[model samples]
Target: MRIKVWITSTVIATIGVAAWAHTGATGVVLERMQGMSAMGESIKTLTPMMRGQVPYDADLVRREADAMVGHSGEQMARLFPEGSGGGVSKALPSVWEDSEQFAALAEDLKTAAEGLKLSAGNGLATAQSNDSGSMMGGTTGGMMGGGASSMMGGGMMESNQVMTGEMFANMPADAAFTMVAQTCSACHQKFRKEDE
Candidate 1:
């Protein structure tokens, strides 16, 4: 139940944050925004499955994970070439100033999505199991922020620090999804411009 509410709320918040239109965006910025929106929609598709509102299909989970995997890593990195910022872009200057960290976070997203692909069944299994204890713990702001939310303004990524691929290597699909979400949050909080 905690997981369901958290995931839904997070996704919703992310989309809400990204409610800002891409008005005036051009070139790579627009491309990245579209990519992020697509990812958000993918996550939205999985939300029901994640919450057990819909039946979980391993194939569907893997396919969605593939979508996330496809949009990330180098494909994601290229969206932020040196001069792509400014004008309608909400990207903060830190993206270029802290290039290495920014790029590493992008790679982390790829790694987390891969883990999600590998652990497709485990996500819904855990969701359906009613296991005890706090899976989300400190993740208050949560889930959706960055992937699409960040790309679109990255969504409301939580305050949880980034997790390493090694850490996510054997996690359940739900947990791996969190890893991806947190990475998105971390990047956007650090890099994206605030909605104000």
Candidate 2:
């Protein structure tokens, strides 16, 4: 009986974790959540390399960037319908209210992801050079691919716009990774609701 109880307890704990991860979300909201989770996982996989905590593998970076871009732009936005934020969703109402702006942000995300993929192929130096100035001085949209320009001080574009000079020649890959991550943060800050 003691062994049975322990097994039951373990099962319950596993179920609890699964439920918490889903957060009672359903339908399109659930789909979006799962998509976001996938993106986060891909980023997590690349973080160590980006941080130089692990050796940088150009092939791995390119593969992960492709994973991220798969869900970007129109493909990602389509998952969020007009009223899909109804069931335990973390999405804000503004998603439907200001959809055009949201669409633009999605495009920016796509651009950033594409740029990262290309940059990884080109070498860390090239990626750092292309992304540095744009991350700092570009519009807020450039960062988040969501329309929260105010959060970032102003609107910015995606990392696709290259900086052609000696300015970022010495910048590191970690900085480039941070800039890319910031773009995701910018949108989440504006569009996602904090857990209660």
Candidate 3:
């Protein structure tokens, strides 16, 4: 009877540990999924703006940018496992081992995204007046196709054009693609499976 009881307890303990591990893995997977979904949505929102299919809306841009920045920060922290010695992420232990550096990059992305949102809120005049270049520049809509003009069916304006209602009123779109892209690139380079 003593032996049987001991065996039973051992089995139970093993099961509990297995359950806990599964739960942790699920949390990690879920975080990745949510982060990817948010980025996809941001791209969709920015499509129209990049293509010049619709004029930029300050409110929509700000809302989407805020979401992207917030999610990026939250996801970064969640990514590191509880005590895998800090950086046991599929991202190669280097990330967790040097957490401070990883965190700084994440913060950089958040700040740049926030700046983009602020610029968007100020409207077209702000976009044109400031020749400092985009807070997250590199041709936002090019992922979809040719330059903005081709994508918008010839409605595309010069990069410096003062965005107007006539250009984007019909289509309400957000401008958070570049920001999201940066986060994705950073994560993929540091953590995700390169072969994937």
Question: Top lDDT: which candidate number?
Answer: 1
So what's the TM-score on candidate 3? 0.50
Worst 10 residues of 3 by lDDT: 1-10
Give candidates' CA RMSD values in order.
Answer: 7.6, 12.4, 17.9
**lDDT of model 1 at position 166:** 45
lDDT of each: 0.64, 0.55, 0.44
lDDT score for residue 66 of model 1: 92
Give the better candidate number (1 or 2) by TM-score.
1
User: C-alpha displacement of 147 in model 2, angstroms?
Assistant: 22
Q: Write the per-residue lDDT of candidate 3 for residues 1-196, one digit (tens) a residue.
A: 0000001222223223332323344456546445545644655565456444578676777777777677655455666664543222244566677677666656545654565565564344224324355432333333233332232332221122333333333111223233334444554466443321
lDDT of 1 by residue, 36-154 (tens): 77677777787677666888787887898899888888888889999888887877889899988888778877876887788675554345335554242223123332222232233
Off by over 4 Å in 3: 1-25, 82-90, 122-180
Models 1 onward score TM values of 0.71, 0.65, 0.50
Q: Give Cα distance to truth, residue 48, candidate 2, Å.
A: 1.7
Best by TM-score: 1
Q: So what's the TM-score on candidate 2?
A: 0.65
Write candidate 2's Cα lDDT for 1-196 as tens digits. 0000001222223223444658778777778777777667666777656545677787887787788788778988998898788657767888788788677677666755665665564344324345656432333233323232222233234444443213222223333344446566666666766554
